[model samples]
Target: MTTLIAEDLLLLLLDDVKGTPTSSYLDVALGGALLLELALAEAVHVRERTSVWSSAKVDVAPGAVVSDPVLADALGRVAERERAASDLVTRLGKGTRDALTARLAERGVLRREDDRVLGLFPRTRWPEADGRHEDEIRARLTAVLVQGLDPDPRTGALVALLHAVGAAPSAVDRGGVPARDVRRRAKEVAEGTWAAKAVRDAITASTAAMSAVMAATTAAAAAGS
Candidate 1:
């Protein structure tokens, strides 16, 4: 099966042993990945920032093929008007991780088990169903992050996305990769100008979006308490 950049990212975020997310921001990260795919497809566009790396807004651009509901829904979020990157992240990524997980389950890349934690609250767990595909993803990422090499456009975008979501350590050093080198290279991919102008803008937009969502979530939690 042809793997998507988002799929690769989702695999990295998943635990090989427990088949659970390694980060709390999996939805945001996955959402950001979907937008990146849209940006690459020209289905979405990020307006140039007024300030350096600030106020990067994403808007639906039309003309790009809407392949699936995931991408379609992502486009819908940006359809009305350009919104702050952060707002877009929260809007587009909301509950999207589960959607991606379901798709993966249908594809046989993962196994889904539905149950209740204490015979009360229903819960779902997707365990590692197959390791071959995820292993390929890991190898590709490892070559770029551990070997100090230039990443292809897609891989570069993945790195930036992971960085934006603060999951680089989880991706690179989880399997004994040198944390320092992995972090340094991952940072470059995230902050580097090596990618196309559109991709770079998309990364910036996603970073802003994740930051905005995290801040909002934090504030809301604090207020509730």
Candidate 2:
């Protein structure tokens, strides 16, 4: 009998990517989520049917398969979320796409886009080539998290805000540091560590800048109206 771990399932989903900058982060996340859910369901099914499997440990009977309704339902839910995320990525603009491609390019994946078609392209070609840029962006973001970059509250905060507003995962990861520890070190940076202080200050400044931009946009619209 084969045993599977959570990390094993994660790898299976990540493996589906073609190693191109254009892979879909949404798909990756969704797939990973589904795989984890399914693994859980399988574990439960096995536990519940322990007696039957044990009685026929060595018996390979035809049509002796047991259906797991729980896993099936979970899979369906994941599929719906995946579809929604996919739709979101498909609607990104050229600027977002370029930003994503640039991030992948930093990691040695160069994507090129033709003005005649989608107007941009990443170096590596994958399924739904135009959409792969977002995937690459997502990959880069996850890489930052894995590397412990502490992108939040400043860089990570901005990235998170962008993510909230529909920025692709790749762009956020590439452009922002990881946000895990930004808050924890805020006071330390303000009182002592120059590096930490600098990061905190930068985040504050960027946030202010974004807020100003939004305010101006809103004011302009109000005045025009």
RMSD of each: 2.3, 22.2
Scanning candidate 2 in windows of ten residues, the lowest lDDT window is 53-62
The lDDT for every candidate, in the order shown, is: 0.79, 0.32
Output the number of the lDDT-best candidate: 1
Candidate 1 lDDT, tens digit per residue, 1-225?
A: 776667788888888767788877878877788888888777788888888656887777757668777888878778867688777776777878788888998888899888887899988888888878877776777888887778888888888888776677667534666676677778887888777788788888787777778778779999999
Pairing residues by index, what is the TM-score of model 2? 0.27
**How well does candidate 1 match the true structure in TM-score terms?**
0.89
Task: Compute the lDDT for candidate 2.
Answer: 0.32
User: What clash pairs does model 1 have?
Assistant: 86-209
How would you encode candidate 2's per-residue C-alpha lDDT over 100-210 as one tens digit per residue?
Answer: 334434444343333323556434332222334345444544544444344423224323333322332324333354343433232222223223333333223323333
Tell me each candidate's TM-score.
0.89, 0.27
The segments of candidate 1 whose C-alpha lies over 4 angstroms from its true place after superposition are 51-54, 173-177, 219-225
Q: On a 0 to 100 scale, what is the lDDT of residue 113 in model 1?
A: 84
